[model samples]
Target: MKKYKLLWLCTVLVCLTLVFVGYRAKAQTFNSDLPFLIHTAESLNGKVTEWTLFTRETVHLASNKSWNQKTKSLHKQFPNMAWTYVKNRDSKTYTGISRKNNYVETIKLLSTNVNGKSYSFLIYEVSGKHWNDHKVENLNKMVSSQLDKLYDKKPVIFSCIQGHFSDKIDNVLLYEKNRLLKSLQAKKVEALEENDFYSVSAYSSKLSQELSTKKKEEMNVQIGLRKSGLGANTNFVIGTPIITIEY
Candidate 1:
């Protein structure tokens, strides 16, 4: 009886392990390569209910508490929420709160000078904002707003509506920033590899600042995006769109 019970227990353990592995495989779409941020979001939905990507230290994208408050405000303020999975380490789950509630505001601390002048960046803390902030609302009105006050032409906007982020926009916000720089004519851009200390934007500003110290200088505008763990070695099979704009 004891030997038979042992055999039954072993069989049950093997079956249970197979079930667990099967469940996880079904939960997160197992793609050998991650395509784009858009593709990742679509593949992860209704899979594992919710799973945090491998814990990468959150970089506190927003500098202050107000930014967190804004995220919360947008969460509450928006009527409809859009679901998206972001690629951080593996992938993170994101929900689009309404535009009124989802506006994001962050400050880029400038390292040095730009175009012969000290370059510093700061924006007012939006305590309560919404997803609508991401909307392609009045590009006309914002043409006069600070968002583009300094630019000559709107840097090739890839905007959709404000309430929810389409696969297109998710790839833009979380991915395209770097790829765009390599394409811009007015500036010298460099595509930095992972673990590089500075983003392309930061690098551009710092370069301009260094140039200011030397002699004549130009403002080198650089768009930047960082990569995550969803690369070729992972289970990021397909259906996810990772937006990689040609630079």
Candidate 2:
């Protein structure tokens, strides 16, 4: 009886240890940029107008034959999407686009030459113009999983979520700027660029990706606001590690 009890206790301990280690590993790998971007945009009473997630990674192939083979393998991963091949003087690209009622997804496998050196890159982007928040989370997970399988090393990821208010706030650019900073819990503003019509602020967020150093400042979150030409509406864009989309 004593031996059986000891074995049971040992088994429990081992199982708990395994669970804890697995949880830690998962927590380390999980990216929180998209979720937090959505949450923050929604908190500001702005409806989600559009969001895009992009990733690019460089790959190496021994020969043109291997490059073709790699392209074929990548196409197999997205069998449902139709692919279009475009070859230029200096580059070759295979672009696949899939469309749904609410969103669109585009994937590109490109090989090009620069300064007499050959380079290959894989790019995946998903964008939607509708206001479905639930679908955003699902799309983020799907994209993250796909990228993990495609890249051996960590790829550069850029996420941008855009929203708009139907009626503008007084001094919308500055007003929302302060509100957004507070909501993000960002104490210091790393960078700022503004005009009468629009403004962009950069900050570091604990929930965002690795710090991006710019001019001796460490920043990862980028928020932009532009006054809409029509009505009193104000448009905003939030990105982690910087916003790439034109606002």
Candidate 3:
């Protein structure tokens, strides 16, 4: 009886140890997880520009400290801040944008952490009118490069070892995770004709509505970028892909 009791105690300790370690790992990962949406737009010119938002969780993006700073020099002293679908690759397909295009660097927004404070990221590449070969080669590179500019950490150059991706499965043209992903199309042409502010507000409003729908649940989302499009108008619209979560 004494021996059996001793063994049981050891077993319980082992199980507790495992649970503790697992919890710690998850906590660390969550802190660094930069949740974001990937989308695409065209310059006033016909250039297709790819982009990503760390997150515009009204709480952070609304902060004055976020969108303005050009350099990280003030990040410590000041404290910080911060697309579309063309196709489906397959059962093994994971969508991310390329960073080779110049538009990607300019339009790219900085990180905006929410209440829990998680960063954001976007990957994009531009191909003229066809997406016969939609590659994810720059997904990691572009993200890493921008990480260097954003954070002071040395190993900022990083990749998501454990992240999820999807294609336009339901909205067919806008969302990747079928059944739940919502579509938010911006004002077609009239908004842009007025000026950049109208177009910006229109784009932000649509994105905000789509995000609000997802907030009802507890899932994480990574918006996808479409490599090709039907060319709706002179403006290169930013397309959204909804990623819903159950846990």
Candidate 4:
């Protein structure tokens, strides 16, 4: 009886130890320091010259800073700005506007906390009647620079709604990812199919097809490093390719 009890206890301890180690290894595979979405945003940013910063948000942080405090910090960086706030049943939006060289730049900040992580969205809306590719590139670069300065350590995921249907954009994104993986000296990179989430509805079908067709010529490859062990890497699509980065 004593021997049987000792064997059962030993087996339980070994199982628990294996479970804990597996969890830790899985956690390490994800680039917790920089979310996959941020990497995708950066990749897309490099591909487009006239993309708008539709939204930027963060999740799963250790900070306890209030939304007001965070917004105030951002405001200090951009002096001579006017802000307006609107409250809805679910969320609040604080919008800041500034004009430079006849171009109106608007930054809308939306704040909410879910579970324990603070979520904030910085929406950059640039106004110009004639927004050529050159102008668009400059605007995106300027906004991205400002964002980088504000959230140096935080991982920001961005969405671009303007150039979602362009085949050129898709090609550039794939090229960049391939180039990046090669630069990283990754042993192998594999393309992932669009998830069912993007294939369910008609609207999603259109967007997913445009962004992630299996056709080799038009393929929106979401390359993943095979050695990363991140488990079936998936493409991020929100009417466009959102996050496609490997740790």
Residue lDDT tens for model 4, 1-247: 3443343344334323322232111121111111222344345442222323332444232343566776786588776779888876556777888877736777777766567555666655544322343454555457556556645332222223212212233334445445544432332222332211121101111112122222222221122211111232223232122222111
lDDT of each: 0.26, 0.66, 0.26, 0.38
lDDT of 1 by residue, 1-247 (tens): 3543343344334322322232111112112111122223333231111111010111233333644454454345433544232434322233442233334322121222346433222221111212222333432243225334223332211111101112223334334333333222224322333341122322232111111211233222222232222231111111101111111
Can you give the TM-score per candidate against the true fold? Answer: 0.23, 0.75, 0.24, 0.38
Taking the tens digit of each residue's C-alpha lDDT, what string does model 2 give over 187-242? Answer: 55443434424434455445545443333454556666666454557777777665
Q: State the TM-score for model 3.
A: 0.24
The alpha-carbon deviation from the true structure for residue 98 of candidate 1, after best TM-score superposition, in angstroms, is 12
From the highest TM-score down, the ranking of the candidates is: 2, 4, 3, 1
Error of 1 at 239 (Å): 28
Worst 10-residue lDDT window, candidate 1 = 234-243
lDDT of 3 by residue, 169-191 (tens): 33333222221123323332111
Give candidate 2 regions above 4 Å deviation: 1-27, 131-140, 167-170, 197-201, 204-206, 214-216, 228-232
Q: Which candidate model has the greater TM-score, 2 or 4?
A: 2
Whole-model alpha-carbon lDDT for candidate 2 = 0.66
- TM-score of candidate 1 on Cα atoms, chains taken together: 0.23
Ten consecutive residues with minimal summed lDDT in candidate 3? 192-201
